[model samples]
Target: MPKLDLGLPSYDSLFSTEEERQESKLEKIVSIPIDKISDFKNHPFHVTMDEDMLKLIDSIKENGILIPALVRPKDDGTYEMISGHRRKFAMSHIGLKEMTVIVRELDDDQATILMVDSNIQRENIYPSERGYAYKMRLEAMKHQGKTIDDFENDIPVEYNKTTSAQVGRKPETADVLGNQLGVSRNQIRRFIRLTYLIEPLQEMVDGRHESEIKIAFNPAVELSFLTTDEQYDLADAIVANDRTPSLAQCQEFKRLSHDGELTTEFIQETLEKEKPNQKEKLSFKMSEIDQYFPKDFTPNRKKDLIIHLLENWARKKSREQER
Candidate 1:
């Protein structure tokens, strides 16, 4: 064999060895321009500019995004952000043009599962957020050929079998998700049901106390079975009357819906019925009552004083009537 002269540069300089290339792929972190990243499709989580977000922005500004975002490269030369939406938003708010991201090769189902799992670890997830997240993850899991029973224990097999029969199907992927999330399977199903709610009603569930009408989770779950049009009708009834459905009223709505008799008029009539909580609750401005109570008085002390005053007034009225 004669020695041959090759004009190519050294292999190490020209291209990485297979092992080195594999190592580089595993070490996927890279700096990508913020504008080059698009949000995950149908991202169920809400990215709000609330107190937590503000704190995150402060931390990132001081610490320079200590954790890198997880993203997937797209065919369009952009990256799809699978997680760290809040971090991205914070970076953008602080005028950062580029962000550190870890790019992973993931299919849609894998990305969805990862997105849900990553965000579900947050402490402030809303009911609606959990609802949509669970639904997405459940679908993804099923698409990946995982079954609900695969995650369930043997103890619940008989019980699940009975319930599954009633529902005319196997225990859904929500059951598997529930096992992972430490929620009861029934509760997981309820949360997934909330995903069917109209946006207004869903927002009511998300913004419960802050919204004009407070919707309890149980009642909201019951209302979720109503058709889209019926849900809109219920929402209108709620806003118009400034009242949310009681559990019993929600049951009535569900019954009507199941019978295919639910209508806007029925929703109004059902909502118009007085609920126990609908009793006129008297509220006084804090400024109006603050003058009568000692400056140092606690709310309990103020309440005691108000009760004593009411008792005295009742006694005086009784005495006047006796005379």
Candidate 2:
């Protein structure tokens, strides 16, 4: 038999063979029954869907779920969901035993990597979710009997360029975390730090009031010296209303709570500040300022008023500058 040579490029250089392109297209399109889905607590995408879960349940009652969820096949002949936990919970609410899911086969590491990738792209991931997810992945790797520190150090130094600034000296935890997640060492440390937060405050952290949370964090740490009720009060003060309580207010809350100086009257007063009369604040506007002037005020009178205001403002400004 004669071997014939065809003048063709190597198979590796081909961007996509006809069959490969077809398979890619098919993979892009999927619809599965929702029933086969099960949540993987170990999945990196496992964010607490408590608030959304309730809302999803209500929505399913009116409008059926419009989006399919993602899942991976388990060796036990079940499917583990990589995402769409809220949809899964809502389906359960509607008494549907199964749900539509697109399936992929992934090992523990691959599943976690995919899970985090799917979730972080969402517009509204809570801080708690981000912090929690990062921590979970860190612990998961640790549980695999692999030291994260070694894994991180083995990764090329070039890979650390973006995230190394945030990370300080690599704790063993930091090494594993940074290496596995391909994140900066600093980011890994920050996420791990959040685990120190108590549950109620952690809930607030997940609520994504970052500015409020940032402001509340130190105060909360200090206020944690007080009992649970006091912490709740501090959170209420920070979250419910926009009042930037003086440092004195926080210290006083701490001192009184500790010294047994806290009383119903004191608590009531603090809460009163938190619940300032919103209605009263909204009652007046620029239009109301018009009422203070005459109904048909002359332009000359307006000019006169402006001159008088300028004179008063200049005096105030001069006094401030002198001081």
Candidate 3:
């Protein structure tokens, strides 16, 4: 018996001409004029003409771009770069007029996820790059109603059930993103917080400015809470005093700022004081050393044990040196 044709057509057949369906099925990769590609809007990663770029240029000269860049078409007859800012940059530097790209039709959020995953795993990503990239991708994931489960293939799957077990509740957006990026929850929080920093202070965090000392990462995060004018005041004081605030000093600054007690003169006075590195004492956070101790050990007991072990190790090292 013939099956009754339900007066219904397949959605594809109903919506499209045969040519449009065929075009959708065709291969997406194509060579296009380099000028037709635009850099990703608000791209976070930097493409410096440094040793890395020189190395990349050399690699392309020898083998060509082994991987096609990913791009998305725009209404303006141009393409927005998604995953190959560095490659595009290298080809441009090499004076190549046309390049290979795989054109993907993705919305903003999906494109952001693809773009971030492409660059975040590179060996040389700076803190600022990771900061902004993680922020962008995390927001994109949340916007798309995604979770850590959706990101398995984009990153190495390292979600160990026994070791990485969460307590109390389901993971939040930042926690999900941190796991995807292999960043710890607390550390990822700090990195995302860096996006709130002003441009000059952010550059100081990157430690690339010739005129100023590199602000320590924790101290910089502490400073991100200050009002804009307060931050400028702090920056001027840092330059005038030839010193960056220590983490402790920045913590104090944060406290004062919250209490409406911070001022330009006070900031100068703080940075002008002796830096924490000049002090004789060394400090360690519990998180850094907790793995070496048993769960029941108290802080004082741990400190005593550490000192005893260090003394024995030093004496043994001295005897080895004499021998």
Candidate 4:
């Protein structure tokens, strides 16, 4: 029997070649059946799949997979999907037997990092998604005995790690991934802030109404600064009003416990005060031009009358002088 030429390379050997290093860089590519794939249950991207995802699946059915997914092999002869979850769903929708994959022997942390880097670039992912991904990656890094502090030193300096250097003070691995993903470090910070929100708001973020939640670190921090009940109260108001509380509301939320200053009355008053004002539309009909004046007079008519009288007086004066 002719040997099946899989063209597979050892994970270490894949990175060793001068030519392959320059050309393909990633180790080996293969076609793996979707049935053999397991999920990272703890993944930030593992939110419930929605009907909107079927649209993405439809696109994939028409175009095939534009970008290959990354996967790591398990000892049980199965593959764990690292990224390209949308593609995976789409593939399953179309009944694809196998998907093109870049197979690597990645530890859990490496797999999560690779998955985040893969998807962070594709679209406007919700702030909650990025936040959850960053938070999960931080925990994963911690499990690996890797603090955000030690990440810079872990990678070989010669590996020319693309995003290792740009994280500002108090850098986390998520920050490094943010740089690699071409998003602002502050954006990474904001998403992680969402981690502190209670489950109800987190669920909102996981769904389509994420904008309904004010997700900045200040609001989150101020909200976090509140007691659990207080955060719940404020969050409830946020939901009921279909609007976020103002900075004053945020400040009141922070200072409520100070000698009973923020009361139910205060909250009601603040809501009333902060409720957006209804705007009235004004229109002037062209047919109503004479409403404020005589039959058809305006200030311009008075000016024209003055000009005519002056011209007549000047002509009469000129005629008298000539006579």
Candidate 5:
């Protein structure tokens, strides 16, 4: 009897295909020279050598970079890093000449969206970073033809079906952006306002300098409305007085700016105004001085006694100076 020849399929024939081979080649990681990779333009996120960064560096040194950074090729033949700025910095600090990167083709809007989304997941993000990132991503989304109605289903039917003139009157972008960021729409708007601040004022808003007074988010947002020259003048006043504006003071600054009367002197005087919290207070733990006072004595009695003793001590000092 003649046996029919039935050839078993080879492993290569079953598993290997042209499309699979192309995909495998695309997924391959390559080491690019560190010098060839440039930082993303106007990267809102900052890479600091803080304790967390030091730990990251140590981990990279002990076990080489486990994940490759994402980068896009530029027309100038250099790669622009989309994510992993800190990883790249750590590798460079570890004396690495080349770093592993996965190169992909991405347009400007796509790259901006990816960059902002990736960095927003970090544990610590400054107000300025969040502001610029949200702004960039919002712009990118708009550029990609995503309208506020796409992400927000809560829009009224009437509003959705409105004419172009009516649609232009809606400010639903903030609501859509806020939904993605897990914040109120107003909060998203406030953060986006920080992007208008100049670099110096923005750094102060970030609280990067220990010696400089840190501006709170609300006041910083208000300050962002100032013109470029006014912001510079306010920065100078902040440094000169070593003080930041309170929310109320910032409102005054904004009002003056709107009236075209905001000057360095106005900024200085507004910042110098004493806030309620700035008032001096004598603080003491109750346990520290409780033994000196009777158990039944009320707080008011204790305060009165302390005041009396201070008055007598002042009198004694005055007498000594006269003698």
Candidate 6:
């Protein structure tokens, strides 16, 4: 009985071509037309003609998309991209008619989870992008049978620890998300809260162009608590003054808004109020200030001259005060 041997191919191996057999063994990859792929609805990540995109296009030209994108078949026969939106753009921009992709049949939630998970791994997601992506994934996770605890209050944040510690409960949504994201649960909640900002303020939070904000995260989160009109007023004030609110100022804004005293004029006035001890800066190009300096002076010599003149002017002022 132990010596008996059957030298026969399996039925599927016997009936199917090697290519067909391989395809049945693994997912089928199709060369899908670029035009047939639809952008994911309300996709959070920005795809700009930035320097990174140029590099991506160059890479595609040199080696092609080493990985096939993931797509879901729509009822109308077009494919909805689940991930690789950037790759899709690069391929289309580089004039590729078709790109290889694996088509799967997924419900909306499954597709959303896959989409978020895949893109969230990228290294340089902007703050706004991270906010919206976290929001979307949280919704998707909830819809897919993960019942997060009811909000302790409005916005469902600021209580991550309590919510995550329910007796006999599965990991809280924030905890799960934080674990996956390598962020603390509280920090994850903070990131999600950024979605409350209006588009203009959110753009500032994302730090683009002259409106780029430094030290805006903590203050911006506080600002998100304001009503829509209040946020707009604050955003307009910020743009008009070219300044982001400091934490203390943002706290006062929140307080005034809650007390029903916040208004456009008030916001503008508050932003105009300079903080104590905040350093003021003035800038001038050498060409602009060169007329004031001898043409033979180097930049360092000019700077030294300015410093010496300021010291002398301060001494003269001191001497006048003694008169």
**Of the candidates shown, which would achieve the greatest TM-score relative to the real structure?**
1
lDDT of each: 0.84, 0.60, 0.84, 0.65, 0.82, 0.82
Instruction: Give a tens-digit lDDT track for model 1, residues 28-127.
Output: 8899999999999999888879999999999987889888999998888899999899999999999999999999989999999999999998999989
Error of 5 at 19 (Å): 9.2
Q: Comparing candidate 4 with candidate 6, which one achieves the higher lDDT?
A: 6
Supply the global lDDT for candidate 2: 0.60
Model 6, span 214-248: residue lDDT tens = 43789888888789999988877877776777898
- Candidate 2 residue 174 C-alpha distance from true site, Å: 4.2
Error of model 2, residue 45, in angstroms? 6.6
Report the C-alpha lDDT of model 5 over 1-323, residue by residue, as the tens digit. Answer: 99766897667876777658667446446899999999999899889899999999999989999989999888888899998899999999989999899988789999998999889878889899998888888888888887642321113333345442334355576667667768776566678788888988888988985556688988898888788999998888788777787898888888888889888877777767767776677898878888999999988999899999999999999999999
Q: Each model's RMSD to truth, in Å?
A: 6.1, 14.1, 13.8, 15.0, 9.1, 8.8
Model 6 steric clash pairs: none
Whole-structure CA lDDT of model 1:
0.84
- Give the alpha carbon lDDT tens digit for every residue of 196-260 in model 4: 66876665545555544443445554454455565566566666655666555666666774445
Q: What residue runs in model 4 are displaced by over 4 Å at the alpha carbon?
A: 1-28, 46-55, 141-146, 149-187, 203-207, 210-221, 257-269, 276-323
The candidates, ranked best first by TM-score, are 1, 6, 3, 5, 4, 2
**TM-score, prediction 1:** 0.78
Cand. 3 Cα-lDDT: 0.84
Off by over 4 Å in 1: 1-25, 148-172, 208-211, 283-323
* Model 4 score (lDDT): 0.65
